[model samples]
Target chain A: MKISEIGEFGFIDEIKDNTLFNPDPVVIGIGDDGALYKTTQGMEQIAVIDTMVENSHFIIGRTGEWYDVGYKAVASNLSDIAAMGGIPTHIVLSTAFRPDMDVDDVIALYKGIKDICRTYKVNILGGDTVTSQEGAVITVAAFGEIEAGKALLRSGAQAGDVVAVSHTIGNSGAGLDVMLHGADGYDELKKAHRFPEPQIALGRLLVKHHCHSLNDISDGLASEANEIAKASGVRLVLQYEDLPISEELQRWAAASGTQAGKFVFTGGEDYELVFTMSSADFAQLQAEFPAVTTIGTVEAGPAEVVLCQGGKRELLPAAGWTHF
Target chain B: MKISEIGEFGFIDEIKDNTLFNPDPVVIGIGDDGALYKTTQGMEQIAVIDTMVENSHFIIGRTGEWYDVGYKAVASNLSDIAAMGGIPTHIVLSTAFRPDMDVDDVIALYKGIKDICRTYKVNILGGDTVTSQEGAVITVAAFGEIEAGKALLRSGAQAGDVVAVSHTIGNSGAGLDVMLHGADGYDELKKAHRFPEPQIALGRLLVKHHCHSLNDISDGLASEANEIAKASGVRLVLQYEDLPISEELQRWAAASGTQAGKFVFTGGEDYELVFTMSSADFAQLQAEFPAVTTIGTVEAGPAEVVLCQGGKRELLPAAGWTHF
Candidate 1:
């Protein structure tokens, strides 16, 4: 009867399983990455909130800059807004620090958050401050305005849509491995983990260019692709040989005794854009956005993401961080 | 310096002192009871986020029911929305719980929240769930909307305006004392603390009736009155003889060797409406809302609140719950 018995995913499912709709203004409520509320002025607004805890999400001793922690905290929420193809406009930060925390440390963390907001051209409107007997708890609520029909969704991918991933993958997973092992040739990966950049502009571009479906790459390409496939009622076939992994990632994966191809396929925290595009549009998109790589094809079948590896198609296991 | 060295209010000041506002459509930001953002549809929206930590905000072995805690959590946030004269629409709840939490117990808590939201007609939109190594952390972000120019403010009270308290005060404070005392005839007072009702409808009525310069009496009537006085650049003279104290509160205060009237005057978490109105409008309001009490008046002077007791006036001290 304890919480762990149901697990974190079960709890999330319990909350979102219902198809309840709020009164007149809310377009979408609990199930999506964010909620869509229609403004009385006929504008669609997106709101997303997420929280991160110390020692649970990040250890203080490893990658110990409070600034980096702040960046990760805000980036997590920003990624949700980006998934909706909305431009984040304002953020409210609520934090509870332990009694022993230094004032300057918290200030530096806020500064780091402000720097990220500055880079994104958003404002930190307001928040709350309270002390806790437990460790640090930070919650961020972000709001953005999106055009009436432009927000991307997980349920929009159709059969025959091509799966495309923006830029490379596995940098954060390799970075975390380096932080754990103190290994060489993975410093850049570690930085990538600490400060993952959210592709907001790319998300907007995808929505504008009529991408079939969109989701940010947070919990690995395989896991996220599986989510899109399940939500969209389609099957996905990914080409592992077509994966764009960096040379440093290959070097680090080799030193760690991990397969570079599998690392790129199943690693997480990339914060890259993984989206589905129409076959005709995909051809035109490839000629323009060279950073985008065609990873797979959507098909009408049971929801699954398979990797074409070693001339064989195999089901990819889900191996990302489960926050709960 | 340690957080204690900075103190609770000092910590809040330090956190918000340098917060720069790039208000694109922000009506009011940090330093208010809540953040006010002008919705894209030109309606005024109120958003407030607050966190409650186990052992810090409440004792684990308290006499109150878990349901009471859940209700109080939502009520506190709803009070903030009500203070801004906005109608509660949606709330996002982020919770982190230790592994020991019973699933049924959490469901009961959720039921309590659902009951209150149903009563207020607010929807539970979206939030996050995470496992905690420590005790539970509950953060609620409540959002509401009001007409563009109808949101009352603390800075709109003018000199010569009548200052009033919406109802009897200090019942929640007395209720807390009852919980700490463990035995008494203070059942109603204690219940008041556990499940305090927010003056949402009353606030809407006041705004509709053109009342100016309003705030909810959360941090004691005296503390909040002082806030209004300072924000409005007016002085407040509160007659102690006119303070409203419940009969049960008086009986409990006598047993505890405390001044019941003084507690009602300065104790916190009453969730009552406090506002100033023009003398002419005050007469009409008295006829409309007979439950309201006119306890003070605004004057042109140095911004401060004074207590008028036994024909003597003295400066009121700021004393309430300090969370740092």
Candidate 2:
């Protein structure tokens, strides 16, 4: 039947009439942007977003990594909450699939997703699935909650706050470059491209330590530092020599003739934490754990990210990754 | 860099480490199925589902009706709420597209969806978009709320209750058959295929007057009635002569040499309301609205949906649409 005949309102009414709704706490169902459920008093809520596309996100023949695709899809959203200091709980998956796509592929996708959910003790709960003349699409809305006073934001940096990174950078981006160019380091670079990790435990630790402010280095360190600067309303001075680069990434970059420095600074999709803390705390943290380094400090004036060499400060160029 | 190399846990850890979390409410994130959010003593939650597909759900060539396809996508979901006797409020769209699908087509789809949302006082809150190698896919998750104790279900039927139908039936199914056959009477049947009206207000009225059991007729009257009967655990005896068939539908069916009875009984996608209520209340409703008919009666004994003809009761044949 023509959808217009039912009209939008009419169609909604029909679906509600057809389905059964549980009636414990919710007063209404099937007529709002988000289903409403009862909650306890003084509780905070968590929210996360993730998107998936067909060809760009997954290529059938070329991607023998379907499992990775499914795993990454969920993990990406969960990372968003971890950054917020919230515990992961329930997820809603919204998806569309073409008729031609084998049901098995979908089964594999869900299997991977379910695996992660089971490991983490999270509920699959509910979601919507539809057919599309276009390709397959997946969007997940994950919910989490944190203590009332401890949710983190991106704007809490202070001057003399030590900058710490969770891991080496540029691997994912370099991996992508290698994959596209068919470079010599096929296996290593492909691995980086397919499976970059998010550091949840460290984020929780930072929250526990009352670290200044932080954000994931999605676009690149240069861009992420700029974000911290903008949010904290402070200037950041970086020492390029202090930046960490993995040995594998350095070898790949060297053989490919791609500057490891540029990759480290501008390459994104690292999914690593970039955070700030006071100088005193930096010393204390260093005394306790040697891996953390003071890469930069927050300054009071001139909101900018500057690279300090010897005694001179050079402005860092901005080159954020573009999706489209 | 293969995806497994990064590993699910590792990838999530990286994402979390790179993010800044507020310690106020969370123990952790990034590694769980769902995000944990703070709870409250009382909160209202709702859930709704919608689906869309490519060829079967939409058209692509000269024969294809893209605009109508978009319209139907949203209409179907909206109809769900209309049947539930509630008002729709929010929608989350999940879409998948092939590599070749035009960006403009995607935009048009959203425009159609947005148009409906605007009319229904619903908001397009958040959704995920992804790519697929096959065709396009779209799913919408809509949510709504109503006053406590006002939501409707399909398990409230009682014997001696009257059966009522909203508007006309068999139009959409006949319309589709007409279009598929490449027959003449294009306009009337096409309207049925392109524009369906969901009976929202009538459903609300049914709820208001305390409907015993209710459901929308998507898989034809007989099929949906069967659902009501099954769910309510009762037998239903329908009067064949009382089946509502539009004059136009009759003409179209006659001209096409299709049985009107079959169209009314077995054809699906009607989106009409089929409800049962106490005889006294049904009589009052029928008095107020003369168009409604007592097409069926709930009975004790084995759960069966039978049609009565010349004092003889025969089982209704199973003939309806199946999504899978």
Candidate 3:
């Protein structure tokens, strides 16, 4: 059945029925003007919102399933909360639906959202749904909590801090290219693109290890590094040889005759945590998280990012995906 | 200049400059993955999201100014919080913009949002801005706080409760008609449609007076009353003659040969609080809020609504706006 037949309230009722995972802290959930929830004393609140527009963020049934679209929408917002060094507790979802859209696809979208929230122990609070004239738009507002004055910020990096990333990068961008170009093989790359995991555990570990600065690789490593450098008023020098590139991504790029570094620097939506800390802290963290890799160092200089390769140095432009 | 010239981050910088009205609770504002704020002890949190799409909620530069669109977007969410008997504290705005759109128009929209937020002493947290393939889409997620266990809900109206509204209704609907049809007179009605205020004070007062149930009128009286009736499992009987219709609306309906009651029952976007309470409590509330009008009563019956006029009664259909 088309969404037009079900109407706005009917669709909302469907969402209400499917949502409500992790409802312990929730006094009110869906079917209200606003949702009410209990707050723990002395804890700081973190809120973030992310929107995924159809045809721009994803092409339904082409790039991935509607389920993937829903899953990624929640993942993106959760990643933001993770970047803040917080534990996500609840989310509110807002959507703009086209009248002629199929109801089953929308339900699948909610199923994906529900599954993710359930996995993360996050409650679906409330959201708004309205009719749109064209493609669907999904916006998720996520809320998390952190200890008082313990949020990880981009402006906390100091000179002599070591820069590290949670895991290998550029796989998501490579996966997108594989889907868009319809290249055969590389199932792992495709899965990386379709289901990028939020680095919530790594973020908490970084905070516990006293990491000074943090950012998520949503707009590529280049842009995220620049953001940290500018916010902290320090320079970041990345070793090109040390940049973490997955073996699968390297093979896919080499087979496709593409430069792997291009995806590493400019590819977006990797959903990995890039952070800075002292060398001693990094050593302790790397012992616990064996996959974490150090690729850069902070220096006392103008706010900038530089790449070093073969004893050569060059400035890195803040080039990534520009929405406009 | 078009937004495409400056890019997405550039537009975000402009918004970052204009926001930040109340900064006491904000630990981290804009320019981050997520915003952080301190939560007060012993207070519950409230969250709601509302979206406005071009040619759907309002026609920019025609039905209202871009500023009004922005103002109403925040007002709608604020009204939701008010219905829950909470004090709005922070908001995150998410917009999907057409790249070719003029930057000045978007700035005006933010100006509207800024002014309303300033009036309410609410802080602008952070949001996401993306490129849409079509017209502008604005979604605002509002956060508020109320005392523990004191939020007003829709399912609390018991039998023998009186149904009341905060103020006159149907003016906004008449105003929209005037603008859509290009009628010569009714400037007051036009203003009503352009700038509807959220009844925050009345909502707080209702909670103070121990009102049983509450809802905001966004989808007209018939629909909102039906929601309350169904949620509370009680029947509502509204006296047609007792609905608080503004004199200007009555004049416009008479001049335009339209039924004023039609607008009262089926028109939406009034943003007034409609609630139910015992007659004794209602008397106490009415003494302080003279503008509050009694139009109905809750009766022990199956969930339904009946309109009574001149010794005749008819079932009131839940016919308002159907988004799909």
Best by TM-score: 3
User: What are the per-residue Cα lDDT tens digits for candidate 3 across A132-202?
Assistant: 99899999999999989899999999999999998898889999988898888888888888898999988
Stretches of candidate 3 above 4 Å error? Answer: A320-324, B320-324
lDDT (Cα, tens digit) per residue for candidate 3, span B1-324: 999999987887888875677788899998888999987778899999999999999997579989999999999999999999999999998999998989999999999999999998889999899999888999999999999999999999899999999888998998998888878778878887888898888989998999999999998999999999999999999998899999999998898898888778777898988999999999999998899999999999999988888888888878842221
Q: Write the per-residue lDDT of candidate 1 for residues A1-324, one digit (tens) a residue.
A: 432345434434442322221234443343211223445453455666778888877777685478888887888778877887777766666788776676566756776687787788765555666776767888888776666656677778888889988888888877887887866556678878889998887777777678988888876887788778877878888887788888889888778887775556566778888889897887777676668888889989887777786688777655532211
lDDT of 2 at B256: 87
* Cα error, candidate 3, residue B40 (Å): 1.6
* Ranking of all candidate structures by their lDDT, best first: 3, 1, 2
Give lDDT: candidate 2, residue A271.
72
Candidate 1 scores a C-alpha RMSD against the true structure in Å of: 11.6
Better by TM-score, candidate 2 or 1: 1
Which candidate should be chosen as best, given lDDT against the real structure?
Answer: 3
Ranking of candidates on DockQ, top first: 3, 2, 1
lDDT of 1 by residue, B201-253 (tens): 87887887778888887768767887788878889988878877789898988
Chain A vs. true chain A, TM-score per model, equals: 0.83, 0.80, 0.97
Number of the candidate with higher lDDT, 2 or 3: 3
